[model samples]
Target: MSQLNKNNLLPLESPKVLWAVAISFLCIWFYMLGARTLVPTDEGRYAEMAREMLATGDWITLRLNGIKYFEKPPLQNWMNALTFAAFGLGDWQARLWTGLCGLIGVFSVAYTGRRLFGARTGTIAAIVLGSSFYWAGMGHVNSLDMGLSGMLAITMCGLLLGQDESASPAARRNAMLICWAGMALATMSKGLIGFVLPGAVLVIYTLVTRDWRLWARLYFGRGLILFFAITAPWFILIALRNPEHPHFFFIHEHFQRFTSDVHHRSGVWYYFFPFLILGIVPWIGLLVQGMWTGVKEQQKGFKPLLMLLIWAVFFFFFFSISHSKLPGYILPIFPALALMIAVYLESAKPNALKLAAGLLGLLGVVGLFSVNKIAHMGKDAIDIPLYANAAPWIAAASAIALAGALVAWFFAGREKVGKDIAILSLAFGGFLAGQVAFLGHNPFGQYIAGTAHVAAINAELTSPTTPIYAVGRYEQALPFYLQRTVTLVEFPDEMEFGLQQQPELWIPTRAGFVKKWLAHQANHEHAVAIVRTDIFEEFQKQHVPMRVIGQDPRRVIIATPVPSQ
Candidate 1:
């Protein structure tokens, strides 16, 4: 613990240097938020939701593509809608909420680490979390996971900071309020799991440590008030407006999705382990030693480190056992892991840091050499060109990481520079490398965004209100790009619940779509339909009236054929 007292070894000792690095990283961070195109099904789905919310001015009942959507809560949509309202709709604006949430997670963890441990641990924890692949990568994306994770990070940190025996009574009360409020917003961000996961962790922590005194400090009466104040109104309003939201959202979205493979997202028990390792990235070498140290260092009274362990390990197992699984499901655990890693790095042997840096450098070299293989990752011809276009940016990212790793290795060996510069160099490298790779992915993402077909669809539009049908398929990003909702024809994927609520919002049968198309054709009305290539072929075989407006190998955009002269 005395090693943490040596401020010289910390990266934050030099205020000017730290400020320069912080400002530069933030610039790149915010810049990249708008730089990348939104990809499906998360990015486009969320963005379009916000766009519709802004358009319709309906904050209570959530809608995706003008149909009722209640798979998750509306906190993120509210933030995103607010972003669109303030900034007008754009790529950066769509992602602003997520970007801010990721930043908030990083800074909050840093502050918690500083308060619980020292300034050194605080700065290092920020570096580890901010540079980690999953956290950093998803921060730029507009997704519900990052928003939920950010609020959870606050809850975890607030609980730890408030429960610390050294905290004054007044400080404890304030921090606990923040913790409760975080849980409320977190619940609004995702679902019940926000508070439920943390509640379970706290219970497990108490039972194992026998810290019976810890429960007294929770301020439950006040906390619950704060929680409901932030969370209850929206739930009440939505339930009141929709009447059916409670059953589908609470029962179907939460319980059914977790207990069964209702969403069809089930994975094996070890689903999150690989992602956890990859999420650790350049810090992987420090993980074991960090967790071991966290376990070993136990103090009288409160056990913050033990609580962190329970938080991470419990959530890992909880999600792994669930029938529903996703790469982002485990995101909330990263902040706790970041704090543990920071403590280990602060007093770690120079050789260990060097080895970690060297391994990252090796990964960079391998990435640089193997980047050409990215072109082959495409499943079809349309994707091959996009992958090829992204290869150069990925190569550049690898080079940047390699250079930073080498610099970190050199500084790790120097007693004077110590771990401060080495940690900063490695973190900066990893963060920048990720941003570059993300920026490079825009070409591929544009196709997924369905932006390429937007112009042709617009060109075929004889009227601004011309009907655009999604036949047996839904291009998630297309409606967002076109800034208008498309009528669903015979396919309801994630929108099944939403469509069930408003059956008139979609056409449920091919015969119904044919009938509608012939009606439009008879009226000499121009209409556009976006369909999969196979579906297009089927429609062609049926002699449906259509003319190709635009197409890729994956999707064909067709318009009503001109009436016979």
Candidate 2:
């Protein structure tokens, strides 16, 4: 044992269990502060549905834009709707429940790490999991990612702990029975992919390791009974109430989404290389070093270490081979990797860590640079101050983490390099905060407020219940902002859906509106706002008339029908 090992931080062999609990609480508190901080992303859509459910008093069907939106399960909406009912339609209120779910992931990893490895391994594992962009990014948002991730981590942790003793009746219950329950929650969170990938990984792992004996731990009779008790009730209730849901959800949504490119989320073969490289963040160096060291020393005997390397690699290739891809698809494997990295670091020689920390610190700087450049492109594209809002905090955090690197360099010979890096985890935390500060969600009621602005300008012409039709297409964000339903026009068959609907608003390309009007639709629709911008001049060149009632870089509101009393 090293000098630091002799002066153990905790009397227990592992401190990670306690550290994990502490970190989970801290992360929750941090996120809880600005539940209303940024606007929701995909979160807004879910939140709005919750709002609609409350508005219309229909909870089971889950509607968006007043249309049936059953693509995603209603777990998030249920949570958000309950929050909104309790606390009002506030952003944080809706997000708070889901954020708590994310904290479950942190707790799962920390506790599981300690249970599977030891205190040092547990702490590093929790930190690695916490530092991951996957969960943390999901943490502050109102999305299914965190909930799905939480259930996954819990189930995996149970499975890991189950490896300890198949014969123990209690362990069997917690590990197999309870683990299956967590799998059910994951399925509820995002359909069946929740249980599917992890189940697949476990089967493959058991096969390769020749560990069918682990199956004995499952206690098939008790396990099956408990699994149905926990998971089946909800499926039965939902499927019976919404009968068509079974065919659409089971066959079309899950199977088709994975096996085909139907969703069109397809990316190149190596889509995740960049995402993973950035997703690990400030600790990319340590993670890389940890993975490398873990792989090289696998013959030295780290079961979780060996298992995770195989797990992450298998899922990576598995999803890459699949027809559909999204950045969040790889989330399940991260907790295992984090734990593995933690274990590898805990087992590393004292002198080796300094070089590792320095390399990681440098890698963080490189990641920041890449993200900054891409953000600039986003800034140009969105014409908003997105990158501008994000750069300073990111740059500063990188600089500080690098300084911590220097500190680690000087203290490399010390036995507590793992401890030092944990302390430095907050520097990475700062980058996340900075990123949030910049890209902070517009909080509901913020964006497309051009919608509200336009409504105000045309309020005399319309009302709280006005019949306004949107020609061509519309942004759903705008309608939510305006609190109105819009009518969409079809192809050249305008006389049917178009003239009959006769929308007051025409949010279409200048070319489409011009073609429709010129075809004897009406001379009245001649004066258009975007027409000047798209037809006569680029959006940047056009100066809108009628009124400069409200302005954002994305929109310019103007009065349409002069005014009515």
Candidate 3:
């Protein structure tokens, strides 16, 4: 009987619930702020591709590495290109659209939750998940994750709202239209996977639940026209213009990239489970607990719970089975997870809530403690970096610890406070993760930008024709950061096929082509010398006309072709 009060979610005027949501939103907004530059993980490529679009004024073809890039569609790049047009090719501008899309996603999640559950669940879920590390981190990034997440949420909302039995015909039609448009935008954001995956899930859910009639009423006649109307022109334009792109992008780049090791992103199955946990850290316990409770409550017929379970399970396995893997691939499921958890917290038993608080607190404490140990880790001695905001992260550590204790106390009185604490704690977890990883010195700091040595090399050896070769392999970031052509030395086949150009001078990999280069040195009459692939190699140690540079630990640099001085 006491659980009855717990079941009745907090009233709209509840100060605790309001504060929890407000705090969560503020934290998420702050966490994602000022992180609008192209980082190594595809940001540089995306930004650069947009830059190329702006430079050539060719909206029809999307090229990366100087070759026709047919992998994904062009809406994101077009949005990014527009940003570039408005603000030049600046990193901040190029990435602004991504952040904006993230904001849209956050808003969609909140709106969807509110409609499906209640104000308390909607606002809290929005706030908590708004501050989520995965969302925050990917939000500001110039990648497809944030945009896809935004479109996915909008589509899910439309689908869910369309399912409302009492909705007016106009409302249902609006939702169906949004669903189609969202699918179109989502496909534009990534590739076919965006529509295929979501479509598969929705179809399966409707089939299992015996709601297939929803499709007929989706107004596909009009919705399909609108979808193609919005999403088609670009595909028609790009495909017609690039000629060989549609097949290459659809089949080889998008499909084969998933089914093959071509991108070298293969991983053991279940890898994303850990990433999913970490991705929504601080919220992991709450999310899992909510999911577990939702599953248990299936007998009671919680439609939202079942929907999210299916949503998460489908995306999890679909990408997990694919040969390609990336951290952002699973972002679409988080909003569903967030709403599900929020709904459960709003509706779970007090004892269950008590268990949730303990789990969330315990998990947060462990995370804070682990970060404490990592804080003292030395930099330069290794790849680890503790930057300017290290102090802030450390400062938040105690607060995080306090949040755990607060969780325990919240449940001691009004059990409604359990959901409030649960939601707020998840936000704090997201804030902490974003602060630790991106703001300052962390292992990620190194990957975020090219080495200053590269900049110094740029300053020294930079001429209109200095010929910057990326010693052996390739990092697409080189072109965007350096604003020059970076030739890959060994992957000549890829360079020819992708980049469609060659370098003036070849900086051979010392280890890979030692004998071949040595024989070349012997056969050549010109004054020739070989350099090692390290920062401190003989000719590369002291800064000359050029110097070696690196983006990460594994990649190295060695300069060559002193330009016939």
lDDT by residue (1-565, candidate 1, tens digit) is 3354466444466777779978998998889888877899899999999999999989999998899988899999999999888889888999999999999999998999999999878988998999998999989888999999999999999999889899899999899988999999899999999899999999999899898998999999999999998999989998889899999988998999989999899998888989998787778778888777658876888988888888999999999999999899999999999999998887888887887788789879988988889867877778778888888888998998899899989888766465677888888888888888888888878877778888899887777799999998888888888888999998897899888868999999988998999999999999999988898999889998889988887689988889889
Angstrom error at residue 340, model 3 = 1.1
RMSD of 3: 5.8
Per-candidate TM equals 0.97, 0.77, 0.81
User: Which segments of candidate 2 are over 4 A away from where they belong?
Assistant: 1-7, 10-29, 32-41, 237-243, 288-303, 350-352, 363-389, 417-463, 467-565
Q: Quick one: best TM-score, which candidate?
A: 1
- Residue-level lDDT of model 3, residues 333-403, one tens digit each, is 88888777777666666555455446556655665566556566646634434432364565465356447
Query: Cα lDDT for residue 534, model 3?
Result: 59
**lDDT for 452 (candidate 2):** 38
Positional deviation of residue 172's Cα in model 2 after best superposition, in angstroms: 2.5
As a whole number from 0 to 100, the lDDT of residue 152 in candidate 2 is 78
User: Taking the tens digit of each residue's C-alpha lDDT, what string does model 2 give over 1-565?
Assistant: 7554676653224457445646664765565535443243465566677788878887776666565555677777778888878888665775676677767877788787777667667766766677665566667666677777778777777766766652367765667766777777777778877677767877876776676776676556875676667667667776787676677778877788878987788888999888786666545656666676446544422255555666678878888877888877777767767776676666566455665566557755765676567347444443445555445545655565566566656655554644454434433443344344334333222543233354553453334543333343334444444445543333212122222223343333444543543442233221223112232234235442233344454554333333334
| Candidate 1 colliding pairs | none
Model 1, runs deviating above 4 Å: 1-11, 376-380, 563-565
